[model samples]
Target: MRPALYWIRRDLRLADNPALHAAARAGRPVIPVYIHAPAEAGDWAPGSASNWWLHHSLQALADALAARGLPLIVREGESLATIVELIAETGAEAVHWNRLYEPARIEHDTRVKQRLKAEGIDAHSHNAALLHEPWTIQTGTGGDYKAFTPFWRACRRQAEPAPPLSVPTDLAAPDGARDLAGAVVPPAGITAPLDALDLLPRVDWAEGLRRTWQPGEQGAQDRLGGFMETALADYREGREQPAVAGTSRLSPHLHHGEISPRQIWQAVQTQLARHGAEGDRLDSAEMFLSEIGWREFAQHVLYHHPEFPDAPLNPRFADFPWQEDPGDQLLGAWQRGETGIPLVDAGMRELYTTGWMHNRVRMVVGSFLVKNLRLPWQAGEAWFWETLVDADLASNSLGWQWVAGSGADAAPYFRVFNPIRQGERFDADGAYIAQWLPALAGLPAKHRQAPWQAPASVLGDAGVTLGVHYPHPLVDLKESRQAALAAFEQIKKGA
Candidate 1:
């Protein structure tokens, strides 16, 4: 049998990887290869922060493959051209890879498969990323679902996902193959070392990211273990409070394919068994699974609506008057975390420094961007696509559209998030605000959420000057919110 090429995409890990397992089971020497083709990602290529995570994740994957006595071949160029050349050089007769749902990627992969089959080379794709492929779940009317609640309910009623596959105990390399995991010998004309890909930034802006994350398969498992041990108990409350380690923080790992959702689902089930008698634990576990379901829903929506990343799913938003702040001046301030709103700024700074944000805080800052600032939701989506390590195409589009009230089951257009109220309610003691906005750390907890509301004497005692030490609120929440409502109402009337 001819050797099989295991083309690595986002599904980076060996464990629970159906494509990798299938390639190995073909009874031929397996050639594991990863092609870095950012241009193919189109307008949503990996940004600086995500690139940093990718660099480390790839290195970790290389080490793991080496441990199993197989080499990882890394290349950078046009994916199809590079892979075809790889097939020629390696004498591989078949190629296997995990499927990606992004529109550009789907088009590219379809073309590649068609070309490979024409050339008499077998090509195959497997579902390693999502538990259920997008088309598999549908509404009672036999059409795609527009809302998450029913979509997830249908998902639950389907057969439970099978147990995750264990990593192959023995990986067979092609005869005459030498162990060369990190070594790079690309098809000559277009080959660069992983370091040469220049995924890291020149400036040292990643110290916080480094401290806050460990980006590999083992690191993902470790983070999940920590979350289960301490944070899972109060997960419902802990996830809401940004200051606490209440959430799993497994998103970047999930995005990079360092771990599979099936693995996570199975692990959560095991953890659930540990709390067999408790109702709260069961409820919290179910809630966490629903978050995963939301991710699935995002993919399903994006799969059906390929243009989701750039446009609103709801037709009414096409005519909605999106605010234009000349030069994106307001958007820039929000991105820089200098908007003078503690909770919003805190979430933005957290994302800038750590490449992750609390889900609740994400909603707060998203609402501020789309509604309070009245900026186009696309602007915020673009910024997040660049800043977030877990910047998934499906989720980013779904989340921003949800906040902007332009997607299915989105927050009602009239519902504008008042950042002050959100902060006071969620970050009641101001721990989250103080941690991210250290300039206002000395302020009493009551004043931390709204420094401008505090009395002049109180501000002086805290050693904070409204505009000097900390800037004043960018826009009055009440006034901006009304403006957003009026604008949305116009769209409604026209619709």
Candidate 2:
């Protein structure tokens, strides 16, 4: 049989990978390859933290494929040129890969597929990341759903997602493949060592990220197992509390395609059955699945609206008067966790330290950036694109646009979140704040969330000195909020 190249992209796992399964089942010797092509990713290429995770994830994938007796070929270049060159050298008849939804990727993949087919090589793509392709789900009028509720409802009405493909345990590789295990140029042109990707940081800034995450398929499974055992029951409320480990930290893994949503959905169902979970337990499981639905919804929006990463979906937002942060001092303070708003500061600090943050805290900080600070949502999005390990274009775009009231089903522009009240309600005990903002650790729970409001005695008792140990709020919450509202009023009138 002629050889086939299994092109690995986001789908980096052995199991539940449709492209890999198809390649193996073609009765041809399969050569697995990962092409490092960051330039193809356009403006939102993997960030520093994401690159770190990608390095580890690729290493893990390489090891797994090697153990299965298939050497994963690592190449670097324009994807089509590299793959076409590989085909010529290996005498391969086919190339297969799971699809990616980002606009640039879609354009590149389409060109490659057409070019490969013109050369009479079988070029195939499969759906592995999402439960269903974005175009497959639609409203009764054959239009994309603008709101999440109707979209998810439509998804639920469809047939359940196909069962995940089983892991390909035994596989045959092409001729001379074993000899090509570590070969940089074994008749297939140039290849780079995994280390040559420059994915790791030169300054060793990721110790906290290393301690907090394990970035591969096994790691994803391990995280899911732990979540089902301990946190799935309280996910509804526990996810809201930052101090508790009530949420599944599976986002980076999911973003990397080390694990599929199908695996997660099935795993949750099986776990529920094993424990005979009912009542609130079942509700929590459903809520967790709905979060997964939101991920699908984000992708759906991105696929239909390819301009999602930069532009507002709602046209009226085009005229919104966003504040200009001269010299970016406001943005700098927010990014560095010196905003003097305890919860927002703590959330930003947690992200800086661990490359991750709690979901509720993410919302609070997002609101503070766009609403309270009246800054451009694009600024916050860019910062997150640089810092977050799980910075998916679809989700990041949806989140920032949603927070700014410029996207589908967005929060109203006038509903600015009061960081103090948000802190009091969510981080009621202030444990989340104290953990990240250690200077406020000695303050009472009441004062920790809003030390500016605390009496001079309380501040003194906590050993805190305003503008010395901690800065005052950058903008007065009340005054800034009204200014944001006034700006919104101007845009509303223009509309």
Candidate 3:
């Protein structure tokens, strides 16, 4: 039998990989390939931090595949053309891959599948990313759902997600397989060395990323285990506190296909079974799983509305008067974590240094950007795309739009976050603020939340000078809130 080619994309793990399992079950020699074609992603290509994760994750995947007696072929160019070339070179009769939901990827994959099938090649795609593929769940009226509550409830009413597949023990490599133990030499220019893809930054800005994350399957499992052991008991309350390691830091792992939602679901189910269903454990477990539901909801929205990344779901936002930053002065300040709002600054700085931010702080920073600064949400969305290791187009777009009050099930336009109040409520001890904004460390916890409000004597005692040691609040909170409300009113009237 001819060899089968596994086109590796986001799904990078050996376990619970449906597409890989199908290829292995064919009883044919298997070849795994990763094609680097960022341009094919359109304007939403993987950002710098994402590329950094990809570089490490791919290296990890290559090592794992080598242990299983297969070599991972790394290539660059158009995905379809490269796949066709690999098929010809390997004489592979089948190409299998996991599915991706981004607009550009959907279009690209649809064309590739149709073209390949027309030419008598077996092209199979599977759902290794989402517990349930987007189209499988729908509203009673048979229309796509715009509200998360209904959407998630519908998901829960359906069958539980299937158990994840185990790693395959039997595998065979095709003839002329590249040696995984040493330097790769491309055969007739069909493949490139992983380094040739140049996914890493040229300037070495990723030291912080390296310190903060482990990028492959083993890392994903370790993170999951830690979360279950220590954090799952208090997740409902602890997740709201940014200073605590309360939530599972498995996003980058999930985004890179290092872990599957089904795997996570099953893990949580096992925990629930150990502790019966009527206590804090059950509540916390359900809360954590609901977050996974939100991730599913984001993908569902994007799959149904392909214009989601660039356009607003609520049409009124089209005429919304977004303030001009004029050379991005406000945007730049926010991006660099100099916004003078303690919680927002802390969140932004944490994101820049760690390539991730706490969920609670993410909401505060996002609200400060679109509501207080009055800047366009897309600016914030684009910045996050470049800096976040787990930047998924669907989730990123949904988050920004939700903050800007322009997405489905969005926060009300009038509900502007007061960063001071948010900080005091969530980080009442100032630990989170002190960790990220060390300049304000000496101030009282209350004063740390708002230094400008502190007395001059307090500022002096702390060795802080507004606009010198720490920036003044970029915009007066009360004034910005009123201005944002007025702008929102204008759009409401027009709508």
Candidate 4:
């Protein structure tokens, strides 16, 4: 029997991989292939941080496949062309892949599948990334859901997602297949080695990323295990505290498909069963799952409204007056963590160093960008795309739009976050702030949050200068909030 080619994309792992599972179960030898075609993703290509994660994740995937006696063929080219060449070289009878919901990917995959089918090859695409496919859930009137609560409720009304698939124990290599492990040049359609993908930075700037994350299936499982044991108990309250490790840091892993939502769902369910679902445990489990639900909602929204990444769901935002930053001075400060707002700066610095940010701080910084700074949300979105390891298109777009108050079920435009208050509420002791903004470490807890408000004596005692040690506030918070509200009023009036 001819072997089947499993085209790996975002779904990188072996265990719980629907495409790999189906290909393995076909009773024929399987050939796994990864095609690196960043341009195919269009403007939303994986950024530096994501690329760093990808480099290591692919290495991990390759090693795992080698352990199973199969070589993960790495190639750099147009995805369809690479797949076709691999099929011709290996004489594969079918192509199987997991689905991706990004508009560009969905369109490209559809075309690839149709073209393959026309050539008489079996083309199979399976749901491996999402708990429920976007089309599977709809409102009472048979339309896509615009709000998260009802969408989640509708999802819960459906049968529970099936348990995750186990890693196939019977992965057989095709006849004449050579183990291309560490091969500088492999024959038969292998164009470049993993290094040739150039998914790492030219400069060695990812040291912090290396320290913060382990980018593979094993690492993902380890994170989940750690979250369950250490944080699940107090997730509800703890997730709110930026200084606490209360939430699962499985985002980058999930974005890279090192772990599947179903796997997380199963893990959470197992915890509930083991500890008995009651009180805090149940609430925490439910709250955590709702986050996963939000991820689903974001993807579904992207699927139904393909313009989500670039345009607002609410048309009124099209004419909303966004402040002009002539030289990106405002944006540059925010990006560099020199915004002079401790909470916002800490979040930006954390993202720069770790390729991840605490959720609460993310909202705070996002609000500061779109509201307090009155800059275009897309500017912030683009920065995040280039920086965050978990820079998922769906989530990134939804998040920015949500903060801008121009998305479906978005926060009201009037709700501008006060960075000082946010810091006091979430990072009261300034632990999160100090960790990222060490220059402000000497300040009192209250002063750390808003050094501009500190007395001259307090500033002197802390060895801090307003502009030299920590930059002065870029914009007055109260004045900016009023300005943002006035601008919002214009959009509200369709001016």
Candidate 5:
């Protein structure tokens, strides 16, 4: 049998990886290769946290594959060039990979497959990233779904569970194959290098992230088991309280393809089935599943449109007037988590400090940056790209646009989130804020949200000086809302 190559991109796991399984099943020698695609070859590539996590995750993957007596060959530079040359060097008759849907990746993968076909080698791809391949969902009239309700309904109807694939027990590399020494790309965009993201925590407090998140098939299983044991039960309440453990926090795992949506979806389903849908546990499971639905919808849009990252699905807002200038003070404040709005600043700091933020706060801060500041959504997107560890093209684009009211079935243009109210409601008693923003840690619950409004004596009493320790609100909420409403009027009028 001719040797086969499994090119691992986003789907890093041995289990439930279509490419890995197919390559193993080829009844021939299988050499699995992970090509760290040259998206950010120089200074323009991956973020601090993503790079940090990638390093650790890849290490875990290598250890796991090594344990199973397999070698995950690493390659750098143009993926197609590497894979094609790889096929030639190894005398491989077939190349198998899980598909990716980003526009740039689509173009690259298409060219790779076309070239492989010309050379008489089989290049097969599978839908391993999403639970339902984006192409599969459609409307009653055979059109792509423009709204999430219809898209999600179509997804739920598939009903057949996405069962996990068993790990391959053994594999062999190509004979005398020394053409590849496993080079890596630089941390995106920069020409000269630092090291692989599979390496460090770009920041601190990551001992928990490091401890909680291990990035491989086995690690994903362990995380899932632990969630089922303790946290999955309180996910609903936890999701609401940023101070507590509520969400799966497995987004980065899914983003890195360290785990599959199949694993997560099935895990949630199994847990829910065991519980009879009566209380917070079941409600939380349902909510988390819906979050997955959003992920599905993002892919569905990306699959159909293919131009999502650069363009908006809702075109009316495409050319909407946005202020662009040399300096963005508001943008600066927002990015640094110094906006002085307790909730907004806290969320930004969380993102900067931890490379992750509570989802509710993600919405609030995103809205403040884009709408309240009358800034471009892409600006926020760019900042998010650099900052978030869980920043996925599909999920991040969908989320940024949704927050900006420029995505399909998005939050209405008029429904600007009141950050204060959101914090007060979801984070009642101000515990979440205090946990993240320790300057306000000493404030009584009632005064935490609007600390600046409290008397100067209150600041003195807490040993927190307002202007010295923290800035006051950059813009008054009431005035900012009026300005945003005005901008919305113009956007609605012409956009």
Candidate 6:
């Protein structure tokens, strides 16, 4: 059998990995490799949180592959040059990898493939990132679906994916006549790169992220199992309540291909089969599934519309006047979880300490920064990029657009999320805030919901002083709401 090189990119795990399965099936010695791309390769880069997770994941993966008697080769820098060198050294005729839908990635791989084919080498790419390839789902005129509901409906109507392929334990690569070994290390003169290359939280305060999430394959599977067993029953509840473990926090896993969406989909299908797919699981499962769709949708949009990430998706919003970070104080306040807004601060602090945030406050805080503070969506997007372990380009960008009301299928410009109302409604008992911000732990749950309104006596009693123990509401809701509404009105009216 011809030798094959299995290039590991985002897909990190051994089980249910289609590209890895294919490479091993040749019964050749599968040369497994991971190419650590530069963190600063692009404008929208992997943030600090992802890098921390990535470093540890690499360590975990190397150990896992070594246990299976396979060397997990770690290469840093340009993949094409390294692959060509590896192919020549091993005398391999073919190299296989999973497909990526990002526009830049597509361009990069296409050039690499063409270059290899010109040299008489076969380059294979598999669709393992998404359930359905971008071109597979289409509209009446053979155009891509722009809106999500129709696209999802079309996807649901089509045949589901074939069963996931399993990773074979015995695959090996044949050694070539020429001795070939290129151990990879950080490239020459790369000083203090961003942290996405390894697995650690961006913000250091998260005992929750450390306790709740594991960064490797085992962690991914354990999270899936835990969600299915304890938290999944109330996913909707758990998802929105930052205080509870309600939803499947499998995004970083899915993002990294540690666990394929198909595995997650199949898991949901299996559970729904036993649990009747009707009650909370239905809502939770479907809710979680919609998140997957959103991921696909972001990729779909970026794949088709190359400029979607850099600029506004809607053309008219191009000239929309928006502020960037107001000042270090403002951005710092938001980052340190002292926004004087309880839920926003809690979520921010949660991200600061743990490198993760609940989806509910993601919108609330995203809106508050963009809509209320009148900052640019890109600003918030970048913060999430740096802070969120699950930060994804498509999801993060599209989510910011949705919150900023400048994206496709986005929330209306007028619909600014009222942080106070949102906090009171979603985090009713203030349990979520109290969990992260211990200074307010003694306050009655009601005081947490509205700390500014509590009388001085109540503040003194709880050992909480407004703007001291906790910052007072930095931006008032009613005034900020009207201001945001006015700004959005201008954005809509082309003012």
- Residues 1-495 of candidate 3 have per-residue lDDT tens digits of 888989999998999999999888857788888888999898888999999999999888887887766778887779999889888877998999999999899998999999999999999998999987889998888889899999999999999999999987787778764432234433322322567778899999888899989999999999999998899989999999999999999999999999999999999988878867668998999999999999999999999999988998888898888898789899999999998988999999999998999988888999999999998888899999999999999999899989988897888888999999999899999999999999999998889999999999999999999999899989999999999999999988633
Query: Candidate 4 clashing pairs?
Result: none
RMSD of each: 2.8, 2.4, 2.5, 2.3, 4.4, 4.1
Top candidate by lDDT = 4
Each model's C-alpha lDDT?
A: 0.87, 0.87, 0.89, 0.90, 0.76, 0.76
Model 4, 123-240: lDDT tens digits are: 9999999988999998888899999999999999999989999989888877554332433323233322578777899999999999999999999999999999999978999999
- Higher TM-score: candidate 5 or 6? 6
Residue-level lDDT of model 5, residues 1-495, one tens digit each, is: 678888877776878888888887845677777677657232236666677777777767766765654556766768778887787777887899998877677777888899889988888998888878777777888889878887887888887765888776655544434313434322122121124423465445565456445666667677778777788877767777777767777788888787888888778778878876668877778777888888889888867776666677778787677756457777898888888888988888878776788898889998888777778888888888877888787788888888888887788877888888888888879987887789998887777888888888888888878888878888788888888878778768644
Candidate 2 backbone collisions, by pair: none
Q: What is the full ranking by TM-score, best candidate first?
A: 4, 3, 2, 1, 6, 5
TM-score per prediction, in order, is 0.96, 0.96, 0.96, 0.97, 0.90, 0.92
Give the worst 10-residue stretch by lDDT in candidate 3. 183-192
Return model 3's CA RMSD, one decimal: 2.5
Q: What's the CA error at residue 456 for candidate 1, in Å?
A: 1.2
TM-score of 2: 0.96
Question: How accurate locally is residue 328 in candidate 4, as Cα lDDT from 0 to 100?
Answer: 91
- C-alpha lDDT of candidate 6 relative to the true structure: 0.76
- Shift of residue 389 alpha carbon in model 1, Å: 0.6
The TM-score measured for candidate 3 stands at 0.96
Clashing pairs in 1: none
Give the local distance difference test score of model 4: 0.90
